[model samples]
Target chain A: MNAFVQLDLTPLLIGVLAAIACALPGNFLLLRRQALIGDAISHVVLPGIVVAFLVTGTITTWPMMLGAGGAAIVAVVLIEAVRRLGRIEPGAAMGVVFTAMFAAGVLLLEQTDTSGVHIDVEHALYGSLESLIWLSADGWGSLLDPVALAGLPPELPRMAAAAALIALLTGVFWRPLKLSTFDEGFAATLGLPVAAISLGLVVAAAVAAVAAFDAVGSIIVIAMFICPPAAARLMTNRLERQVAWSVAFATLSAVLGYVLAGWGPLWLGGTHAVSAAGMIATVSGVILALACLLGPHRARVGAAREA
Target chain B: MDTGFWQAFLAALALQAGYNSALVAVGAGLLGAAAGAGGTFLFLRKRALVSDAVAHATLPGIGIAFILMVMLGGEGRSLPGLLLGSAVSATVGLFLVEWIARRTRLPEDAAIGAVLSVFFGFGIVLLTVIQTMSSGRQAGLESFLLGSTAGMLYADAVTIAVGGALCVGVVLLLRRPMTIVSFDPDWAAASGVSVRGVDLAIMGLVMAVTVIGLKIVGLILVVALLIIPPVTARFWTERTERVVWIAGALGGAAGYLGAALSASAPDLPTGPLIVLVSFGLFMLSLLLAPVRGVAAALWRHRRFQHDVHRRQGLLALARREAIFDRLTLKVLRREGLIRPDGVETPDGAAQAAKVLRDEKRWDVARRVYRDETIAGRYDGLTSIEAVLTRDEIAELDRRLGPPVSVGPRIAGAVP
Candidate 1:
């Protein structure tokens, strides 16, 4: 029991917080049809992190976060430019820019002395979440104590703060975002700064992505940004409920994925567990699949009936 | 900078020196051509990123295939076996995307993102598991994550060549139907073309190309080979046939050049350098293509705006002779439509009269015509006569007086 409390709870807390943070802005992205922009930002942030490491000669959070945020904004700008100038579809434009950026990041990592650094290319790609440990208490009783809380992994508070900022922003701009997402022309007629609101939403998403990057990596960040909102969208039609459901789904996947990753291997006769981040993404996928199959929208049944 | 580096680079580039290098180049070139051709249809269909989803989705199949092979007492590194697994899984991923799109209110992008992340995540889990296996032959499988041409065997090259050729051949045979479906699926369906069948065929070809290109470009970058060449080709021409051929050639060139460069530079990876090269071509075409390129488009827009300004200036001068600005007068004189001393030429008189008539006609139409009639007839009109009926013209004549006749005092007219 002591081992369980010490070993599992911190990672689980970090995962849940990160997932919820991502899901907040993800709901808007899903609504705006920019779900993949989250994916793109996640990919493009690698070079930002690497460059930050080179500049600061440390893998500290603030510089890395700033660099990643800048890269994410650049990614958004480049994607827009490519889409507008080349007359390409947004998805293809994103694919082109983000993949190139990621490839450049890989190349840069290889060329630089950063290869020996803690944030190697492999870590950037797969992540090392299992190593994020925090043991502040002797056992379960003191786990919630102030000293214990202070000893939590730094990622926990950083992710929580980022999540809180995102939630606050979303709450403040909820009406404008909803109006613009559903009807941009209508929002414009209402004299709302539709473009500014949209940009704000994108910035919020980027912030969320940067916050989640160190803990879950880009792959899980992308999955959280897409899967929860999508599943929530399937389950409910109301925007408010969608956000709520998304958060719920995000938390559920985070906790469930942690459990499965830690114990799933034992069932398969393997001595070790798998990647928690990967498992979290997989669990989100399973939830989305279930939502598709049996959500209140009755998608499959309705399609069959229509046919 | 160093002699050893230069020496190694030269040795790597010797044209006839290594059989394996030549084979890898041919295989990559073939794969690029096939991906290019297949990508044209995908792009035209506006499903360019679907191939990315498909490519990422292939990783789990690779992982699962390796485990199955090892469990069954066969070498898990067999190229065909792994590729087959990837193809099957990629097809399944495609089907899931389609199903989700058809069944739910979720947009296609949401569906694609979901399937891509989920499948890739599962694949990563499987890969971690595979790493712990006792067989210890998992080293070759990691190349599928980021392609490495350094390990290309002659047999692998043959597999790529044959698979690529098959994909290209199938594309050629089904070119007409594929084109129809891609451009206008509704029309294709109405015209007895099985839209779904064509879609499946294209998807099959995409899957095949993605699977075959996996070993060379890796699954992550294969979509680049698929998409970049076709996008670049689009800049050069509007014709589908030309686009296909150009894209294929560009893809082959990028692949060949990229492979050679990667071989020359020991530090560079083949997949990214190839993508970067293709990206370079895309940028060049985007800037330099004659008709659709950015520079050309901007030039066209400027010329159009200038022409509009000149026409407006000419009309303003024609409307009020007191405003006979020197520039407008000079332009009219240069065109031999007007003479000096403000005398209108016959050509100038005719043009001025037409412009006056058009102005009067539009004025009457705007007030007198019903909104629906105006919209139906006058929308996108380049000439006033095209939208004006006899009755409307007569009405304009009665309401706005007879068209102003060009006389000597009106403007300078050159004989």
Candidate 2:
């Protein structure tokens, strides 16, 4: 029992699932020119969390997740309305909506301390990954069947849920999502239900955002969403290749980040072990930096070569 | 809201009793407008978003300044020392962003975003360290997070005023050259305009305004102030000169309003509020402008539809008359394919042609038709005795394609 508990594979498993879930939808967000929507949504979700905490008197995951999701949808709606009614450009509208929502959230938190729910600005920004303390028995059953994965432990359930959601979303909207991202006007002319596809993409991103936020804070969630897609873009300009590379990169970062965080303390003589989320961000950033520097399809190099 | 606004206004006036805050606000607004106006050219040049990068890119420099202040044991009480450090760090950051771009394959936007995030993260890390080290009094660093007019001493205001005046002076002196560069960089270069120098000058103006406005608007809202007002002003006019003037005014108004709000309500963050207000103004311009507003476009579209239908009705009536009269048609036939007796007829031809004939031309045509022919159906010719047959009018319609795509076939279609 001591060995089983000490192994502490639960967080690592959850991290993997979260990263996969995020990277899947994140690919479309990056492609659709809504690259910063994740950042926008992350900030906008603050007020939602505040409201949820105020109502529930606790910082359990579900209320905060639901609240964050609702706020994100509202943000998307607000951005659209602002663009239509005011003729403001997309980027400017997004900036205004997110900043306003974030400010409102901050103001609310400052005005009310609530019943000491412990969901403060720190939690809003840097998340409480340590909350993955319980591993559900039902979670294990769904994750593993008798013959399918009998050897796997109960921790696999969380990973299975994350993987299943990501896989299902990716499978369902793969074609239309790509078409909408490439040319929205053309997609509409083809009688594609553009509104439904766009909504699906947003919902997918919100789900992915919640899943990733559970492991890494909102601040780093943006980096996770943007960095992998950006790095993949650097490696290959083609959309298909970018999605493939992004998923692979995200999975690798999760495993490596968890391993480093779990074991590096033993070697370095410290309890703080470099934050796994930070490490993941740092690694992803480093990968992007490398790709930017060395990638062949770079504009300047391509220009120089053509010249 | 009204009473709150008035109270806020009075409190702001009181805060500016010595006129120091007022002076700083004016200086910042002037400098910000100059930066923003210059941004118009940059924005038009498709590099508006670079301002966003430059704003965040300054963070590392601010962090380095904080570190230096700590090293010199002047952390909390030294404004001059901090400013000097920040200036050096900011220039370094600018240099690094350019260098990285030169050495890499990153597109400009992605490169800008990356540089911004990395430097901002570095600043956050430095700030965290600074917080940890301070013991007796927390570093009064929260001011930088959302600007503090409480620190706007007279000297700071003067420094900003000088910067603003210098920016405006330089822009005036180089206005012609800058316009040439903006309108046609290649042409300016070919005509010996020193394109590189003009670009460097514009960049210098951007840096000066950013540095000056940093104290008034804070880091995050500085870019918005610099870009949004100029973007908003663009909707009201087509001329570049008017755009510059209006944009400058908008920026100044926003700065004044923001300062007043901040002074009155001490609790509200000034930068974000100012940005929100500016965006509100931008929305107003988009909706209500007479010439280019969305409302105007919709109105013009309706008017155009009405005019087209009215003209089509006149042409249809004229075509009916041409089909019956042979001698009157022979007179029309000589007027081209609408020949009265033996003119050619295209399958789908309108009879009435609304040509832009001058009075003299109409008088001459009327005289020619007086004794030419007075035969079959000529009722449609009563308005203007000179007749035009269906085929001739259809030929004219074929030459004029409607500007916008109407629902199906254009009503002005020859048929």
Which residue window of length 10 is worst by lDDT in model 1 chain A? A298-307
DockQ of each: 0.55, 0.22
- Please, what are the lDDT tens digits per residue for candidate 2 over residues A255-296? 776676556655666444444554555456666777766765
lDDT of 1 by residue, A110-132 (tens): 66776455876556656767777
* CA-based DockQ, model 1: 0.55
Off by over 4 Å in 1: A54-57, A135-137, A140-151, A300-304, B1-17, B137-140, B315-415
Q: Per-residue lDDT tens digits of candidate 1, residues B1-415?
A: 6886566446545544277777777777888888888888898999888998899899899989989999999998999999989988998899999988887888889888899888988888888888788884444687897787786888888988888888878978988998888888999999999998999999999999999988888887788888889888988988888888899899988887777667765677878777888888888987888987899999998766555544654465466545445665666677766677766677876776776566556766777776876745653224567776787677767887554454445444221
Position A200, candidate 1: lDDT = 86
Provide i-RMS per model in Å: 1.9, 3.8
Clash totals, every prediction: 9, 9
